[model samples]
Each structure stands twice: as structure tokens, then as C-alpha cells.
Target: MRIKRPRIRQKIIFTLERQLVKGAHYQLLLLAALIGLISIVGGILVMPSGEPTSTFGESVWWAFLRLSDPGYLGDDQGNWRRFISTLITVAGYVVFLGSLVAVITTWMNRKIRHLEQGLTPVTANNHILILGWSNRTIHIAAEIFQSVGRIRRFLEKYDAKKLQLIILSEEVSSFQMQELKDHPMIGTRAHEIVLRTGLAIDREHLRRVDSLNASCVIVPSLAYGRKELISPDIETIKCLLSLNAEAQAQNNQDLPYVVAEIQDENKINAARRSYTGPLEVIGSNTIISRLMAQNIRHPGLSAVYNEILSQVDDNNLFSQVFPELTGQPMGRLKRAFTRAVVLGIVKSEGEHFSPQLNLPDDYLLEDDVLLVLLAKNSTDLVWRKDRISTDYAPMPFLGMLPVEELENRINILVLGWNEHVPALIRELCTYEDEKYFIRLVGLRPIAEREKELAFLSENGDRVVVENVVADFIRESEIRKLAAETFDHILMVSSDRMEEEEEADARTMVGYVLLEEVLEKASKRPSVLLELSDPSNESLIRRFQSEVIISPMVLSHLLAGIALQRELNSIYNELFTVGGAEIIFRNLPEYGLSSGKKRFDELESLASAHGETILGVYLDRPDASGNHLLLNPAKSHEIGLSDNDRFVVLTTFY
Candidate 1:
């Protein structure tokens, strides 16, 4: 049987009710229609006796004013006008004014709710998209802002209207928003940042931040939480997979470059496999371990690396293809730049590039080869063709001297323990020719550490590992340990604490106690500190110790890789064992003691010994408030002293 249709009147009433329930906009429209009907009826029904010249249009205007404002009700004269005005005012108060306020309030509440949810999709294109956030979020953002040359070039390359950094996380909290807003760069340029809330592993959520169209996407490792067993690398891989899935239908060239941080070295390969695009996977553990080992070998190397990686510093690594200097030998290229130090050349291999640093003197630059330089800015990398004079005579190649032997047997005291200690021990063991005695003091039991380091049992000839269970937070324990004679000390951030700030505080207190105790000792050991939070870096600056802020270093590395992917291999080579290393050699060792010499002559002399003279380390601080002056003018003259050292890049056998 067929159902009968509703009457037109019934249908109209149903439609009106449905429209009112739709939303604030529809409800407002219905109220306006009702008010218009009421005003028209009132306009035709009444006319004041005091104003007999009022036309129909004037009457309608009078009714509208009275319905809109209650003050017009008192202006009526005749009884008929007063009665009509009273009815209209009563209807306006209940239907027009009340409903209008309700609609506005509802609309405002909806908008606020929407904003809090962070569900709205961002419309920015060619922006940097950070997928997850932790204590490192602010550092990452600051690094990006500090990278002036890289950021400017990225915008120009993509033809982006402005520089924008959009962050997507699980939730958009007010505290997080305020923290970002308080940043100096973000505060002035508020439109340059956009924060949204969503799961990075979800394809639907990835679209909210327009990830596919972003210039670069950074996936930072997540900090461990209470009872959280999942590795951060797993989440990072999932994020990469989601991004890949989202971009599968799009052109390969349109996909954004991704830089992901994997805490485990084994998971790095898995992460790379998850994303089939331009990708740079950072192995945090290996990096931290290699740096720690390097720090133990070279006391002040941390400061040098910090200065070079920092965006606020004067000298930074830059690369540019100089077609004009094509065919010039690498040795002669030393004087090619007035403000930059030519480190090496970057040779492109189709889709990839390899950095050949400290190349042989006779090696000539080819077309499309980029000069790897260290300078204050890219603008300072000017090709000074005039500096390479035609009449300049080459310095005579000097005979190579025998390698100077370093301290063979060294004692290292470790104040704390974490996953990186084992890797650090292994890295130090890689220098097999030298013997290292490592003593570890931590809150964990000795057995646990031994089990973790059981694989190193057979390497007794290279490294001797000793573990002592002690509370690093206790001042007496630190004093007892600090009194012992040691060549170097490493203070790792405590992972026992639940919060990053707490871990940093514990580590800082230990460092302070160590310093206080060592102040009385006859010999002070080189102390290397690892801080979990970058904000605590200023707290220990007065100590002048080798401080490694893990988050800041990661952020800097990620930012650098985002700008130039080739820097990944270069950094790995510089940091790892069995590769080129930056070292400080005594002036006497280089056969220079008292005579004044030009910087280029020094470079030529170092090249004769298969080394590159980067700069000089003085006994006193330079004008820039640092002991090291990197990449000075090639023609700048300076006298060598017993205390002076030349910073050189040489292959560490």
C-alpha cells in the first residue's frame, strides 16, 4: 500500500522546524523572516495622529525602529499607535533580540570548540611540517628560525610566499601554543607558524596539515613515557609510512623531503624502507656515542662542533657550485675566497653527492663540483679571482714528519649510565691501538651493566670496563669519584627520572659536585656533560666544560640535513672512527715555531703532509669571545707560538 503525502501547510511547518534545528545560521534566518512579517503587519496597522503626513514607507520604517529598539515605544501618541507599538516591542524582545543573541552565542561557542579540536585543515603550501613534539619541539623551531641562509633559499626554491612551520601533534594544548608564541621569531611573525592536533600515523590526520605539499617533514623521536614500552622508532616509521601512503597517488617530484630520527641503529634501515622518497634517517644513539668517544679523545672538540653547528655562530659550513673556478686545483683554491675557507669539493653522482674533503693538492675541480666552504655567511663565499695572483709562487713541499704518539693508556671516569655508554665503549674500543680504562658509577646494579656490555668481554686488550653501583645525585659519592686520577670524565643524563628537566637537574648537580671536588685536586680531568634539556645549557656555561645538549644537537643536525641532505654523510664521516677527523696540532709539530707566516702558506705546508689547515686555536680568546678562529683570510699574517695550535682535518688511522 502507498503512503499518503502530507498537506502543504504541514510540510511547511516541518520544513521550518528542520531549518531552525539545522544550525545558528539557519535559526537566525528564520528569526529574521518572522521579524520581517511582524514589522510589515505593524507598519500597515498603525499611524500616529501627531504625524498625519507619514507615508506607507515611512510607517514601515517607524515599525522597524520600534521593533528593533524599546526606546521608540514611548514616542507613540494615539491609543491605536501605542497598542500596535507595544505588541511589536513584546514580539521583538522575545523573538528578535533574544533569538539573535542566542544565535550569536551559539555560533561563537561552535567556533571556539572547533579551534580547540584543531580539526581544521591548514591551507599553507611549501611549509615545514613537524609531525611529533616533545621537549625538543622548541629547539627544532628555534634552529629552523636561526637557519637564515637555508630557510631563505628553501622558500625561493619552492616559490613559497612566506616561510611557514606547521606542527601536527596528538593534542594542541594551550601551554604548547603559548610556548611557541613566546618565541622571539614566532612572536613577531605570528603567521609563520601553524599548530594542529592529530595522530601522525593516520593518513586522514596527515592531510590536515597538508603534509604532502610541505617542503620538508621532520619526525623527531618521542620521549619515553611511564609504562610505555614501544620504541620511538616504531612511531617514526609509522609516520613515514603514512606519509608515503598519502603521497603514493601523487607525482614523485611533488613529495616532500623527510628527515626522521630513529633512536635505534637497527631500526634506521626499517625507517628508510618505509618511506620511498627523499629521506634522511638520523641514528641518535650512534651519533651521541661517537660524539662522546670523540670528546674523551679531544677535550675541547665539543665546543668546536657546537660552534660550527650552531646557527647563531659566526662560522658555518656552506656549499656552492662555483663554475668560474672549474679546472683550478684544490691546493690553489685555498686563496680563492677572501672570507671563506675552502674545506673540500662536493662531487655530484647523478642523484647523490659525495664530499671529498682535504683532497690531494693536484686534484683539480671539475664542472658542476661544489666548493665545501666554512664561512660566516654564503655571501662571504665570494670567488676572489684577484686573490689568486698569476705571479704567486708555490711554496716548496716540506718533508713529512713522523706521527706524534698520544697518551696510550688513559683512565676515563663515567658519572652516569644509559644505553649510550655501551656504544661509547665500543666506539672507544675501535681505536684498538690504544688502551682505555673505563670506570662507570651509576644507580643501576653492576650486574645489569655487565650483562648489557657482555659482548665487549673479549676486547679486554683494548678497553677495561669497571662498574660501581652508586647514586650520582649524592654529593659525597661524586666527591669520592672526582678525587680519583682520571684522564677524562663523562656525565650522562640520568634516565631514571620520569621528566627531562629532572634528569637534567640531576646531571647538572653531579657536574657541580665533580667540579667542586676537582677544584682541590692537583690535576683536573676533562669533564663532558650530557643534558637532556637544551634550556639547562646556560646553567653550566660558567664551568666551561664540554657540554652536549642532546636535543639541541639533534635539532641542529635535523635542520642541517633538511637544508642539505649531503651533510648527513659528511657529519657521519667527521664524527665516526676510521674516517677524517678534526684535530688540533701543536705549532712545533707542524715545523713552525716563531716566524710570521701567511695563512695560505700554512695551508700549503699542511697540504704537503696530507692535511687541511682549518684555522688556529690561540692561547687567549679572539675578538669573537672564543679561543678558536676558523676560516680566516688566506693572506692574513700571524706569528706562531709554543702555545698556538693549528686546527687541521686529517685521516685518523
Candidate 2:
């Protein structure tokens, strides 16, 4: 019986020891109890010789004071009493105070480490939410700041006090986060940004940012460092699914607007299936391909697109509803607004809205149609009641003379292979009565590229694509391609490269090699280069080439949509096919002499031809090295040359 009792007591003692080891708080509590017990027992056992026998409560009180402060032992009388007092005081210092200090220090360090790791949740409302981190994020952040600056400069009633942006990303380290905040463009707005380190697909992380209360969520494609993911689009879809699941769990019917950048156009439908909300998918590769094709066909048009896309200064695209000018003829509508150049009328057709750019002179506006105009600012577009006149003569609809097609087939050389290559080939095939001979030069095998582009071959017979297996960065291969034989040289950045700097460096090498090869030839082809990073723009500009920085352009679009939601529709109308697009038409075709003419006269002549003139581009740069001017004043006189071209908006058909 005695042996069994000892074993049971040992088991109980082991359980307490395990508990004390498991929890710091429990250990602290046990230490406090031990101090109290020692003080109470000591107080009862000892007393001064001259004093009356101390009561239990009085002795306890005396022991507590002595334990707390060693000075309480100075008046002790007997050796045993003094020894007990000193022992209590020493126990207080060694056991109670020491453990308390150590526990507090450990707790504080743990809290600080957690915060430094960016695990703390953010509690902000109406803030912009940015998911994922990449090289383009810095540009996106810059564009957003620029938009806010524009609002602060123009709009007086806007509440510009608290501008907040919460970024959620798993790959962003604490040092990297600090560096981003301290960046020149971002550092100025550091107080407004909150960064958290967590995967976007994690529900707990999403809850931390209060996703339901966000004004907008921008999901950028994942950075190239994420090797586990097959592609950025897959990661984006996962995030969307997680976000939707969270929203559904909370019964939130009104989810925030989500703008996601997708790399592959085919994955758009899959992304849409994940989120049952207002989603805008920007196809980065598709849009870049379209822009490249457009720039190739029409020289110096990239500048106009850049100006309209970036709202850096005042020149931008604005849509206004002028009830006063409603039901007026299209011709008179132009003169009614003195400040803005009325581009077209936006009318709804079924579920989609279309822009009518080449309306007849006497066409009447029935319902309230949105007027698209290019102006410095919205305030510039004011109703000029005095300028409005109903008695204007109806002008005949003028049509541009068909351009004479060359007898020879057009040859285009593509220097790299990417997702955009197929789209570019399809776009090039769309030109009427034109035979396109496209040669794809890259490290990829010809069979693989052909398999990927098998669908295009079945649909179109106008484009003949041939692939050459060779690295364009090699000077010998560049020389072998016969650079002088092609009409256009298109350099595409390699998407397979994981690092943006490495991809851009390869592009630079290719361009340099191509330029060296072209120098020895008699013919100089028009060069159009695609860049992933805008920082490389200056390096590539030394060559006579038109540079299209797709990442920067996409970032601007994302930022613009976040700031003004209506911009999504405007951009869709402008960039897509079968819509009004900006083009450079020959000035002489409009019947204007080669001399100085008022912008209003040119505007009237353009309106007569069913076109809206934005500005002009000299074939050669002026004294200030300026080639393209957009949104010029109406009264400003511009000298025209037979070589110059008119920048105008006209229908493709």
C-alpha cells in the first residue's frame, strides 16, 4: 500500500512539472505562490524578543514588508529572527523579481519580432488593396500616387487627408518592404501604406486587410521568383477563389471591384469562374501585341497612346453629359464646346456600348449619349451657348481614298517568342488585301511554335509564318536573317526568362546586334522593341526604334482604373478592334495646302472627312526634339508640310 501511494504522488508531481514547462504564465504564477507561502510561514515563525507575541496576520504583514524591502530588517533583535528576515528578502530578489523581469523581457521581444515579421493585421477602411509583389508594383504604386496628386491639384472638395494602401504578399521580406516604403515615389506616401507578409490565397490573411471594406483590389501577376507556380494566372485564380469564398461566407453580396492582370487570354474565362463579382481582367500580353501591331502599321502613334493613357499633366480622355447640346447635329456639337475636341458619341447597343466616331453631319442625338472628348481637364469642357448654332449647313460625308497597296509582299521579322507572338501574327493577318510573310527567330524549335499557332493557320491564309531556330543575341545569327530584307523589325522580350533584368538585357543585346547588322545594309527597317522594364527605355532609345514598355503601360491602366472606374470602358473602346482607333493620316489627303493653318480650319476639314483631329506629328523632330503634339489649342496655328501627318481618330472600316 505504501509503495502504491508513492507511485501515485510521483505521477501527480510529474504532471505539474510538465504543465510548468509548457506555459510561461503558469510558471510565473507558481513562483508567485511560492513567494507568498515563504513570506507567510516565515512571519508566523519569527518575532522580536521585546515585542508581544505577534498574531498570525501581524507576522504575515511584517514578513511581507521585509521580503519586499531589505531595509525592514535593520531593527531586528535576535540572530534567528534576523536570519529569517534576510532569507525572505533574498528570496524576493532571486525568485520573484528576477522571474518577473525575465518574463516581461521575453514577452516584449516576442511581440516586437511578430510586428517586424509583418504578421499584424491592418484595420483600415476604404483603402486600396494590392495583392502580390513584382517589379511592376513600384510603377503601379507610382501611378496611383500620380493620380492622387492630380486629384489634389484639381479637385478641391476631395478628402485627401488619409490615403491608405494595404499590400498583401508572401514573398516580400521585412527588409524589402521597408525598402519599398522608403522608395522615392512611395516614401513620400509611406504613412498611407500598410504592408503585410502573407499569401493572398490564405483566408486568415485576407481577413486581416478587411477585404470587404476595400475600395478596390488590384491583383498583379506574381513575380518571376515564384517557381512553384506554373504561371502567374494560376496563382491569381487561386487568390480570386479564396477571396470569393470568404465573401460568400460573410454573406457579402457587394464585393469590392477587382482588377486582375492576366498573362494568358485563354485563362480569362477560368479566372472569371472563380470570382462572382465585378471583375476586370486586363490581358497584358494581348494588349501589348495589339499595341505593337498598331505602332508598326502607323509610325509615331505610340506617343499619342502614351499621352492619352498616362494622366500625368492635364491632357486626358473625358466623358461628359451635356444636356444642353443634346439632340444637336454632330457637326454643330463640335463647335458647341470651345475647349474640348469632341471625339465621338457613346451609345448603348444591347448589352455592349459602342463609340460612333464618324457620324453624319445631320445625325440627331436622340437619347442622352455620352460625349467623348480629349481635354486638358474636365473643367475645360464647358457649354458655349453663344457658339451653338442650328443653321449650319449639312456637309457631305467624305471618305478617304483607298491607299495604294504595294505589289511586293510585306516582310516582318519577330526576334523573340512569347505569348504575344501568336496574337501579333493574327492581328497582322487582319489587314485587307495585304500579304504578310512573318519570320519568327528565337531559341524555340519551329515545330513547338507552329503547334501553338496551329489555330491561326486554319483561320487565316493571308499570313505565312516561318520559324528560324537561332538565338537573335548572336551577331552571326542576326546577320544571317538578312535584316535589310524585312519591312519591319519587331523585338519581343523573352517571357521564359525568370528575371526581368535578364530578359531586358537579352533584348538589349539582340537590338544592338540587329543594329550592327543593319548598318552595313542599304535599307533601314522600322524597328519596334517591346520592353518589360521602363528603366531600360533610355538604353534602347539610342537606336532608331519605337519602344513599348508593356509593364509600365499595364500599370498605368490598372492605376487609372482604380482611381476612375469609368476608364475601363474608355480603354476597352480605344484599344480593341472594330472600334474607333487613333491613326496618323496623310495631311494632303484632307485637301489642306502645305502652309500655316488655324487648328479650327484643320478641325473643320477633319470633321468634313468624318474625323476628329487631335494633333500633328512631324516626320522629323522639331528644334526641341518634339515629334508628336496632342490636344493642341484650337486657335494655335500649325505649319503643315507634305511630309507631316495628322493625328486623328477614325474608324478602321
Q: Which has the greatest lDDT?
A: 1
Per-candidate clashes, comma-separated: 0, 0
* lDDT, candidates in the order shown: 0.80, 0.76
True-structure RMSD, every candidate: 5.3, 4.6
1-653: candidate 1 lDDT, tens digit per residue: 99998699998899988998798879878888888888888888874443741677777778888889999889777788888889999988988789889889989998898897688998877889888877667778877887788777778888986778888978887778788878664565544667799988998999999999888998888654624466677888999988888888565456788989987787888998898878888998889898888778777777777777654456778777888888887767876676787778777776577778877677789998878888887678787777666665556566554444555788999888776788788788787678898999998888889887887878987789988888877878876665449989899987677788988888998888777788888888888998887668888877858888777778878877887777787788788776578877888788778768888888888988888888887777766677777777878887666787888888755
lDDT (10s digit) by residue, model 2, range 14-116: 9779967665688778777877898788877775433533677778777888777778778777888788878888987876678778867776887787786
Residue 14 miss distance in model 2 (angstroms): 10
| Candidate 1's TM-score | 0.86
